[model samples]
Each structure stands twice: as structure tokens, then as C-alpha cells.
Target: MIQNIVLGQIKRDPRSVAMANAYGTIADGYFAVGYNPAMLAYQQDKPFMLQLFGIDMGIGGNFISLQNLNSLSGDTIYAAGENPKNPHDDSKDRLFRQFDDAGGLAFRQDFHLPMPIINYSSGNMAFTSNLVWMSNLVFPIGILELLFYGNGRRPNMDMTFNVEVFGVNELGFTFAVPYDRFALGATVKYLQGLFYFGVDPDSSRANLVTSDYHLYGSGKYLFRFG
Candidate 1:
């Protein structure tokens, strides 16, 4: 079976969209609670700033060219699915040629809640508390090839699907301190997995909850002597 999908542009607020440039707060205003915590100390005396209900969604992939698929006419290579069991000829070759790339499809969306919950700043230290809902989906060609016999390696043309949907609810705290031309930042997060649905070729899974709870943290030091 061959599948063709076309993705669309996502819409998000400025704050959420700016998260992509979270490299090190090189742009205007101090952003990115984790990436550049130290920059928080350099901000104006706002004492508190809130981020409410911002969302981010991104799609990137070029597995197959839609133009190529649409250009074909009746009885073309992508016309219909045929039984590979009775095939031993050039028709098999045509099936492989239909898909342009068959690489993979990736999608992710982050929902920032209306909880600055702790967007407070004091002296040279900044603290932030927030929650984010994240989800990701990826369908790789290699795995699809296994399930669909797209590579024709499976003995039988039997088709199976591997659908995995992952979701995470994360609560995080960020702290930052700046000194002269040096800056330091740290972030701690508590993660709760919402769902995990997929077929594990190596193991077995009946439900979609992989991890109940998890903890993650990171620290960064920036020596900006310039």
C-alpha cells in the first residue's frame, strides 16, 4: 500500500514561534527558559511576565512528491494495489517506483498552558514555572517498509501497521543568574507520560503508557567576555 500526505503550515503566537530560535537568546528580549536562563538576569525590572495559551506546531518532510503522483494518468504505476503473491514480473517493479521517497513523516505540537505559575524575578535571579503538553509522531520508511513489505523482503505480502502516538506532560522550573560578562542557567523538569501507542518489533506492548513519571534537569554556563 502506498500513502501520500501533504502537510500544512502551523499557526502559533509570537512567544511560541520564537521558541524555535531558542539557540541562546541572540535576538531581542530574553526568552527560552532552559536554553538561556542566565539572560533572564539581564532583563528589565518586570518582576513578573506571563505566557498564556501559546501553541507551537511544526511539520517538515518531503517523502514523496505530490506533483509526481498527480502527473500520472489512468492505469499508471500508482493506479491500484495488486496482490504480490501472484506477481513474479515487471508489475512488481512498478509498485516500487510509485513512491517518490517514502522516507518518513514527523509531526510535533507543544501547548504552553496559561500558567506563568511562577514567573517571578528577584535581584539577579530569575525563576519560572510552567507546564507544556507535547506530542510527536514519526513514521519512518524503514519501519513502514517492514509493515507494508514495501521493500518486498517479507515472504508473504501480508500487511501490518505500526502506529505509535507519544504524548508528554511536563512541568518545569528554570533559574538563572548573571555575573558581569558571565551568565549561568539551570532548569529542572518533572515529566508525566500521557500515552505511547505503537507496535514494538522487538518486544510486546498492550497499552500505550510507557513511563508513569520521570525527572529531567540541565545547567548551562555562558562566558560572554565580549
Candidate 2:
């Protein structure tokens, strides 16, 4: 048995992302709600801060990139006919070689939208609200090989994949109390689950086997939603 898990959260501020999350100690105002709320105490001189509108989004993948897309855009990786146009082309082989044996190719995306009129900060207390959405997908290398090279060379293949998506609305109240040498701060958050969808790995199975005289395969996928 083999299992893998990937976990991540989207950065809510561009400055945090640009600084590679090193801005936590210095974060102030409404931005400190998610990082170090204690830092909010240092913003006493700013009077008040209001966030009218803001959006953060990101998308990327291990096996997909601008360079790879440009290189494989017009190339035909596979054809069903007996005589194909590019019979000597190695594009299919090149694509198959990109994956390793350890794990599948993965892609992820996330979006964050701060509520406009509700996000505000004053004195040592602040209130904020946001909507967040996240998605992830994985394609097994075995499935890619089967798609690119067919069953002629590899008689057996595994067709397992993973996918997940979820969304949530968060409302938080933050407060900070400053002392002579330190500060105490905390954030109270209310989370409302908007939706969730994913494949049940424990209940899903798929495989394929081919031979000269016969071909056999089985597939069962269980999806869950909330």
C-alpha cells in the first residue's frame, strides 16, 4: 500500500507572498489578523484602517508550466489511425518521460476574496470577513503512460487519480492589548462551510490488463460531497 498527502493554504496578502511569509512579525492593521495579531498593537498611531475590496488568487502545478505548454502546444502526442501524419515523431515519448515513479502529477489553485464593506479595523479591535475556495488534482503516471503509449508495450496499468475541491466563508474578530514589554492578542473566527467534493480513495479502484487474445479491466469510483 502507498499513500501521499499534500497540504497548503493560500496567502491572503501580496506582501506576505512576495516576502515568502517573512512579514509575519511586522504585519499590522487588518493584515495581522491571520499572521501575528499581536503586531496590531503597534499600529496605534494609524487611527483606523478599512479594506474596501481585495482579491488573491494563485495556480500552479508540478508537471505543467508555461515552457512545457509552449513546447507541447501544437504537437500531436497520439493518433488512433493506422497511418498517422507524424509517424516518426517522438513527442509522445518525450511527454511520458517527464513523470517519475514516486508520485503523480499534481495541480492546485486557490482564491481569496475579502468582504468589502465588512472589513474594518479601529483602535485595538478589528473585524474581518473573507470567502475562500481551493482545488487540487492529481493524475497518476501509469494513467499518463497508458494514454500516451497504449497497451501495446505495457500490458497492465493503474488508473488511479485524486481530486478535491472546497469553499468556505470566514468571519473573524481580532483584538490586541499592549503592555509595557509585550502584547496579548487573539482572533475569534466563525467558519461556514460552503461546499466540499472529493473522491473517496478507500472506495475507488481501477486497473487494466491486455493480452494478445483478450483484454480485461475493472473500475469503481466513489465520490463524496458535503
Candidate 3:
């Protein structure tokens, strides 16, 4: 497992997200702060721009969808030694098949709220701030297999899961200097980490093995905070 923190503007602008980041070249005003600060110099006519209130939110996953949720909502998963409500139901098998050999399911959610009265642009300079929150989760295929099918088919199981949640306030000052045929720009950013909570995937490990007579497994989880 690999874990790292990457700091930058990711899907912060609704227009950019809608355009699939194709707005980089024509980005202007407050939107140019991260996409391309040099584009700010092109906003000669728009002397002032202020963003009072705006919000950008996104949620996505590999195995999560409305149809999938509706299909599995009524299905019940029973514990070991417990009688299942529907013994012949294929819901469990269907759910297990959703995961591939690489992994079970991965999910991510992010929210970007531009601080009111702080996002402004004047001429070739801009000051912007945003409150950002993000979270991620992963369910390993081995764990899912063990849960649904037990360790009878696969004697050995690799159980590795990951989770991360963090929030930060990004404050930036962007400026541009235009020349005859070119422009130079820069954005100074101060990332104030509000909080961080995650499981250290590299250090966390878990495994299970089953034999004819006994089953054994061990797990260790390392959590991080800031």
C-alpha cells in the first residue's frame, strides 16, 4: 500500500470540473488563481470580481452507485453460525463479484467551500481562500472474500484496508506580470492543515490462514493524526 499527501487545487472550481479542466487556458478572475495565474493579466476589462458564496462537492467510487445500492439495500448479511433470512439468495455472490482481484472498492469524497468575502480579484492580482475537506476509503478484496465466502476456497487471505480524512484551509495570493508577447505569474499559498486522520497503510498489515483443523490471523493498524 502507498500513502502520501498531495496539496493543490483539485476540483475546486465548478466550471473547471464541468469542463474537465479544459478551462485552464481561458481561466480568468478568481478562477485563474490555481489553473493559470498568468491568465489573470488578460482580464483587463474586468477590473474587480468578488465571489461572495460558492460551493463545490464531489463523491465517487469504483463500486458505488444508485443501482448497486438499491439492489443490495434489502439484502442481509448473516454472521457465522446464524441462519440467513434467505439461504438461496445470490446477493452475497453478486456483491463479492463487484470486487476485482486487485481490490474490493475504493471511495472518495471532497468538499470545497470558498471563504466568503475573501475570494476577490482586482486587475492583475487576486486573493483567495477556501475550506477544503476530503476523505478516502478502500476495502481489500481478500477481506471481502473472507467475509462472504469464508476461508474454505482460499486458504490464505490478504486483508489490507486503508482510510484517510483530512481538512485544510488554503490561502493564496496570485499575481501576474504581462509582457509584449508573454506573461509571468505566481501564486503564493499558505496551507493551514485543519486536521488529519488516517490509517498508515504501509505500516498496517493483516493476514489470515485456514487449515484442516485451525484458522489463524493477525492484524496491526497504525493510525496517524495532525
lDDT of each: 0.42, 0.75, 0.78
Assess every candidate by TM-score. 0.48, 0.70, 0.68
Strongest candidate by lDDT: 3
Please state the error at residue 94 of candidate 1 in Å: 13
- Model 3 lDDT vs. the true structure? 0.78
Which residue segments of model 2 deviate by more than 4 Å?
1-11, 60-103, 144-153, 210-217
Could you list the CA RMSD of all candidates, in the order they appear?
A: 15.1, 7.0, 7.2
lDDT of 3 at 159: 77
lDDT of 3 by residue, 1-226 (tens): 1111432453246677678678768786888876778888888785898989988787888777888788668767544334466556565555666576436689888888999999999999999888988898888777777777777777888777889999989988889999999899888888899999999988998888898999888899999998
TM-score for model 2?
Answer: 0.70
Give candidate 2's whole-model lDDT. Answer: 0.75
Clashes of each: 1, 0, 0
Worst 10 residues of 3 by lDDT: 1-10
Q: Judged by lDDT relative to the true structure, which candidate is superior, 2 or 3?
A: 3
Where does candidate 1 stray beyond 4 Å?
1-23, 27-30, 61-158, 203-226
lDDT of 1: 0.42
Best-to-worst TM-score order? 2, 3, 1
